[model samples]
Target: MSVTTTTPETTSTTQPKKRRLRTPYFQVVASLAWKDLRAEARGREMVNAMLLFSIMAVLIFSFALELDRQAQEATVGGVLWVTIAFAGTLGLGRSLAAEKDKGSLDALLLAPVERSALFYGKMIGNFLFTLAVGFLLVFLLTVLFNVNLFRPVLWLIIVLGCLGFATTGTLVASMSVHARAREMLLPILLLPVILPVIISATRASTALITELKTEDWLPWIQLLGVVDFVFLLAGFFLFDFIVEE
Candidate 1:
């Protein structure tokens, strides 16, 4: 009996599945930015320092010069921008230094994510922080300078100003964080490059406050928009190189 049972060929139903790869770009960026915010919230050091510095700036401006309503009106733009700029520097310096000191920067670099996202995340976080400081300054300055800083036009100027400031500040902070004299180096390196933004923003803000022709304010606002776009795009391209080093 040739019991040659023809064994049916077994069809293999299992196959190796392709794995989906996650880049972690958004996740890493959000976590990194959130880390900074959470740390600042817990300590309250950065916000407190900025508030104190802004208040002091307002006080100094109030007493620095004798000014009636016209003079104060003319000078309001300068005072508000200067206060925000100085306080912004303080916050930027502290935020970057904290990351560097804690080795979080290195870890973030090692994370498998596109570097541009990191820049955007940091910039957005800084923008929010600086915007808070700016709003507070506007309120305090309105009282101190006796000027109506809450105007819709003035608010628009503030938005443009904050955008410009945050974009440049984030990029500069990336570079300055790695330097030996990072704390001191940031302002020197940052201020020169961002002067155009400050000048345009200040001028626009002043024009808006004084009810000048829209043509006068329009040019400055346009200039501010250009600067913001330039810095933002430049930072996006350059962040990868900065982080690699």
Candidate 2:
């Protein structure tokens, strides 16, 4: 029998490489996302607070407004987007702050998985939560505003809008979690940055609600998609640096 000897350099390089390849990237991301979901499911605080806040906001807007068909068409979009923005902001701030408080963020940062995967995992969790809020808002708007928001295109717009919001909001929330006034700082940092998303979503949603031509609303949706892509890129590249800092 011939015996083969492994060199130290090859052993060192290949062992770490094997370890890196051992854990699939998608598995890491899914596990991280599942962690958030499991935590939220156990505590129920995050989703409860978000749903309560959203319902109250919807009720207030429904009662506060006196709008004709044309007015509702124009203003419903703004109301929906505004409520989503605020509720999503609340959710993002609380989620990250809790992680920071529990030292889970530290654990995550120290984990062997990729930083960008961490960002995406957190973002997916936030996206799902915010998407639930968005769906609820749609139904509430349909009933309260007497406007039909049940269209597929409108739902698509909502998905894109929430994706963009989650992408940017995740990055900003991570940045602000270390701040003393994170509650205040998150909105300040996030709102201005996601203005493009809000504006596009609002306009596209309004156009769709009003039964405007495809050309009118399609461009806004496209713009929202582009914004989501850009934010995703920014977060993917910058999360590593931000978490490092």
Question: In terms of lDDT, which candidate is strongest?
Answer: 2
Q: Show model 1 residue runs off by greater than 4 Å.
A: 1-20
User: What's the residue-level lDDT of 147 in candidate 1?
Assistant: 91
Q: Which numbered prediction scores highest in TM-score against the true structure? A: 2
CA displacement after TM-score superposition, residue 158 of candidate 2 (Å): 0.5
> What TM value does model 1 have?
0.89
lDDT string for model 2 (1-245, tens) is 99999867644344534444436678988998899999999998888888899999999998989878899889999999999999998899887789889898898888777889989999999999999999999999999999989999999999999999999999999998898988889999999999999999999999998888999999999999999999999988899988765
What C-alpha lDDT, on a 0 to 100 scale, does residue 1 get in candidate 2?
100
Model 1, range 1-245, lDDT digits (tens) per residue?
77787989999898889876756777866876787688778998888888899999899889896799988989999999998899999888876678789898787677667789888888878887889999998999899889999888778778888888988998998988888899889999889977998899899999888889999899999999998999989987998887666
The local distance difference test score of model 1 is 0.86
Candidate 1 weakest lDDT stretch, 10 residues: 20-29
Query: On a 0 to 100 scale, what is the lDDT of residue 39 in model 1?
Result: 78
